[model samples]
Target: MQRQHSFDQTELGTLYLVPTPIGNLQDMTFRAVDTLKKVDLIAAEDTRNTQKLLNHFEVETKQISFHEHNTAQRIPQLVEKLLNGDSIAQVSDAGMPSISDPGKELVAACIEHDIPVVPLPGANAGLTALIASGLEPQPFYFYGFLGRKPSFQKQELTALANHQETLIFYESPHRIAKTLVNMIEIFGPQREAVLARELTKKHEEFLRGTLVELQEWATVDNVRGEFVMMVAGNDVEEVDESLVDLSPIEEVVHLIEAGESTNNAIKRVAKRRQINRQDLYKEFHEI
Candidate 1:
């Protein structure tokens, strides 16, 4: 039942969820750097990694370790600091905090204890790659990462198989190839997809193709970079009860039973099933 007036001057301290650059240092926002300079303490996922960013920005603000391994032990200490009117800013190893990052739990804790949580938007890898992907940017589902285990990953992908919105995911260099293979199994070889990596930096690149093509590309000699994968929606039309029992060839036959020409029937069925009309025609006539 708590509402946050983030900018309001209050007795209790605020938790600032700060975002760091995904790759290029220039992408770092002015406000993000300013906030980092002013905050009482910075809770970083990796102090060593964050030191590079802090050093670049000349942000002298002291930092404490706050990452996945020690979150339970750190939250209480952080909460205490915040409760004592010490404004704290939390940052991930890269990109936005609390987004496939470590700040989510602390944000929840602050909310439960009535501490104000203020978020400052900055560089984000998922959206950065999404806009440039040449895919439908709106109606996007930001699924950060899938399960690590093969069985669990497959189960998760299966649940998302029928989703109509553009899908977004983050994967490590080590797992991208296997993940694409799994995607091919669930979403079919023809499904359109894009792979973006080394975002915002000099090595930034986007590999666009179908699931099968990307699967083959993933096995190339060099598969190394932070990856953001974008998958197209399930473009298939609703299965008509009459057409459900028919194969692609049979569906064309059923359509031909009507007054429509064979070519037109194949076109209609292909539109419904999201397959190539020419391919449908060839398969139908060959049978």
Candidate 2:
């Protein structure tokens, strides 16, 4: 286990994760600004946008582009700098560095190289939405973004069906309707959920309702801005072999709905019914 004493003196340079404002510039913390000013270089997801922030704070730290498209190339170079005792700060366009943003790979590389990774607390869309969501905050799961593929998204929804804790997801405006439809299918239309849009901005808004309600609301207009979606968790009893009163398909569906993987659900149901796994799989999918 690696213990990090963030302020302790060390020869190696630190990888500071600085969180910029999600929308409101006032949300940017003083420590974040100080770190931005002090770091030897800033590894930004978008240099142009970060430059605007730096200008706003009167910070003159130089920045190099480090985003998804160029992470593989940039990580090695950044690691080398860290190894050379040159401190670096990593920031995304909004919120924390690695939450649906770049910097995760670089942090992993730093850990591998024994470089200290110090994160300063600041703005985050997920936690900002969570505290106001009226949902259980302690056990919520932060699912940054879902798979773009329909089938894969469905599988992911199936896997998350039975979570007893609250669930959070980040979604773009363009795909909210489609994702809500999938959630309705898997989690049922009545499950409680919230949609927080353009958080901390002048036009920030929150929509609270059931999944089906959200599905309808998403279609009301051209949905705009990034979204933070929080949904209530699975409300169901434990599923096991003793559910003898359930039909094969029903049992399998229950297990799948309760967050059990599709393959595991099929295997368990097949074993309980003393039937071939292949036949049960076929029946489950109507294949």
lDDT of 2 by residue, 31-75 (tens): 989998999999999999999999999999999999999999999
Looking at candidate 2, the ten consecutive residues that score lowest on lDDT are 235-244
lDDT of 2: 0.89
lDDT, each prediction: 0.90, 0.89
Highest lDDT scorer: 1
The clash count of every prediction, one per candidate, is: 0, 0
Backbone clash tally (model 2) = 0
